[model samples]
Target: MDPNQRPDDERLSAWLDGELDSAATAEVDAWLREHPEDAARVRLWAADRDALRARLAPLADEPVPEAWHTLVRDGGRSAAPAPAPRRGLPLAWAAGLLLAGGVLGGLVGAGVVWNSPELQVALQARGWARPSPLAWTHRAAMAHAVYAPEVRHPVEVNVAQGSAAEQRAQEEHLARWLSKRLDMPVKLFDLRAHGFELVGGRLLPDAAGPSAQLMYQNSGGQRVTVYLRRPEAGADTAFRYQRDGELGLFYWTEDGFGCALVGNLPKERLLALAEAVYKQVEDGIVRTPDGGASRPDSLQPAGGRPAS
Candidate 1:
């Protein structure tokens, strides 16, 4: 293949991981050299990857926690399968990084699960699918990881801390602007019923296209983000869930839009919120064989079924 032919993110990522064969690696190397712009982007990715490794590297030195041993032991006994890795290091490495959390890189969040190979196997024994490498889903998780820690300016538009009417107006404006920009109906899923109120949202840049992130918070001040965008070609509408360090995510596609609800909430809590979102989204569309614009009582949430 011509080096001038641009490599997609996956190839570049593989190059970063040294996962590509020599020929492919050389091709990417040549491509990077000939295209300074591509090289710059790859360099940024390399930096981030290195930073993450460095952040988690010390964990490998600490004594493995007793909990890790127990989980790994039980994992083998239970015959649970680990989550399949999508890129870079194996899932075990990422999963190990979670259990080692304790002021390490300050990446720890609530409701995080240790997803090492054995633990993943255990999760699989319980019939859970590993989080897929769906780009938007990972982006949602990354966005949450980046902004959830902010004590100020977590979102561009904040519906909270404003008068009731102003909040409503802001909510309306957020929905309208994001919908128009992404060319999809951007319903601000009402999670107030589940103890989380809208905190407003902001436009986000996505490699696939323009995306939006809506923040929500509870009385306790815990925050979550809903990342939304139009579905890519061949995007599945399966309601999927994944836990990354402290972040828990439930993502699905509906009515031509892809959405991922991200937070550090427990799986059950996140599921309830996700279901609330699913129901609200379902309410806005009619269910018909042809998906005609009519509502039905038995409509199921997107992602092919409701997440258990």
Candidate 2:
């Protein structure tokens, strides 16, 4: 393979899995070195692959289930066997079903799922099935982990830059630009009451389409991020909280919108901030042209108190 020749998707995927020969590998490696965009995309593929493996690794050593055995032996005629009567069976079955659907390399490389009735059933039985919105919530967490620690260039659009007038202009621009990109109304929530102010936001890739991340900081320099995207039709709307080591997240869906707040603050404090955001969202508070928060005419109730 010529090192200068651009490799196709198949060749790049093979290189990712280490299935390419030394010559092919060298060619692909050289290509990636010269193409930073391709290199970054491959890095995302690697991250997704590692995440999937980590999530399913616990089930690898478990015994194959009797239900799976019966299903394999009886072809497609076997009644959906009982949910495997073991801890790891659900994930194991999921892995098997995914593998049986298509080549694993292609599936992971494309960042997609092999949807089927049986696969859906298996995933739903274990509360593992969800629409793309739920999947991107994990991406929200990853985005926070990657960007929150930066000393500079923490956000793509820095609302904190320049004079107060310039900062306000940036805030409005962030809101309008994200709303346009996501095809949903994006508001810059007022978290100053909870000791956080808008630092800015950036567009992000989601499972379905583009999402947005708004970064905020407190007087003490502690940072938190809010992630927003348009919810898919029939997405789960339940409010959920999750913790990964020291990071705490509060995520929910409402009125065709998905939002997740991620931070390393204590759960109680993070919950307070999340609640503040929820309240502002519920009230339809948006930044006005004069650099103050107010509700739109459609959202303002008769004699309703103005947003603080």
Candidate 3:
């Protein structure tokens, strides 16, 4: 906003966002010190600023491409997902779009689970009734894609901190983490039962946005990954189940997230496994490298579900 056209309150916001020149900022800062109500609003702005920084912190000071705001705000839900924003902007700008949802609400950001072409194909397969196993493969493959690339931390509970055996133990803790959110009697499918042991999982990009994924393998070493995200599209439906080709997939959205159980298996068998695994995988508990569970403290408020 032009400094000349800015209203008193707007100026205060500019000051808070650090948009004003040093002299103007100092002026607004002084005014806020004297005005209790405005000061309270400043505090709110500060909280909001911190929240947005934390939510987008992973992007490495990358510029939220012009398209990101446009995509997010205009309900960019094309079947062909938008490419992730170009990063490494000059970092000279002092202003931001500041999503109207407030910086705090950015915490509710659905992580990377819904942008992949593979996953989008899965969604289309379910609806289009084409060779469907690809959908399941889409889901599992993404889970591996998102988390395995981490540098500082991989799993929420890092058994890697201890012995090699301890690292495997982290797998067990990861299972428990899923169980906690799933709110069910959760367990890794015993190789004898499902022919797969839980290897590990990580977060990933998807058509809907960011998501969590879990990987598993069987005695014969067949593998699967479960991908999860905050639900979008027909998420309110009880469940939209699908199976195509050699892959198996079951997906659902609950609370504020979407989940897909994926594997290379037959339709009925994979559906059952997806349901059972879905029941076992947790909801809303995005685990951090430090082994603590974090939920989106900010929400989109009632009736603000972004359009597909």
Q: Which candidate number would show the highest lDDT if scored against the true structure?
A: 2
C-alpha RMSD by candidate, in order: 14.1, 8.2, 18.8
Can you write out model 2's per-residue Cα lDDT over 99-170, one digit (the tens) per residue?
A: 544355466677554345554455445444343435767778777766776665688899887988898789
TM-score of each: 0.55, 0.56, 0.36
Q: Which whole-number lDDT from 0 to 100 does residue 132 have in model 1?
A: 52
What is candidate 2's CA lDDT for residue 168?
79
Point out where model 1 deviates above 4 Å: 1-134, 285-304
Worst window of 10 by summed lDDT in candidate 3? 88-97
Model 3 quality (TM-score): 0.36
45-155 per-residue lDDT for model 3 (tens digits): 454344344433433433556655566777866546666433323121112333332432222122211233443343243332223323433544334333333344434
> Is candidate 2 or 3 superior in TM-score?
2
Model 2's C-alpha root-mean-square deviation from the true structure amounts to 8.2
Question: Global CA lDDT of candidate 2, please?
Answer: 0.73
**Candidate 1 per-residue lDDT over residues 216-282, each given as its tens digit:** 8999989888899887778677888876545679988775888888987889999998887777676
Candidate 2 stretches with Cα past 4 Å from truth are: 1-134, 288-291, 298-308
User: What is the TM-score (0 to 1) of candidate 2?
Assistant: 0.56
Worst 10 residues of 2 by lDDT: 299-308
Which of the predicted structures, 1 or 2, would earn the higher lDDT when compared with the native?
2
Better of 1 and 2 by TM-score: 2
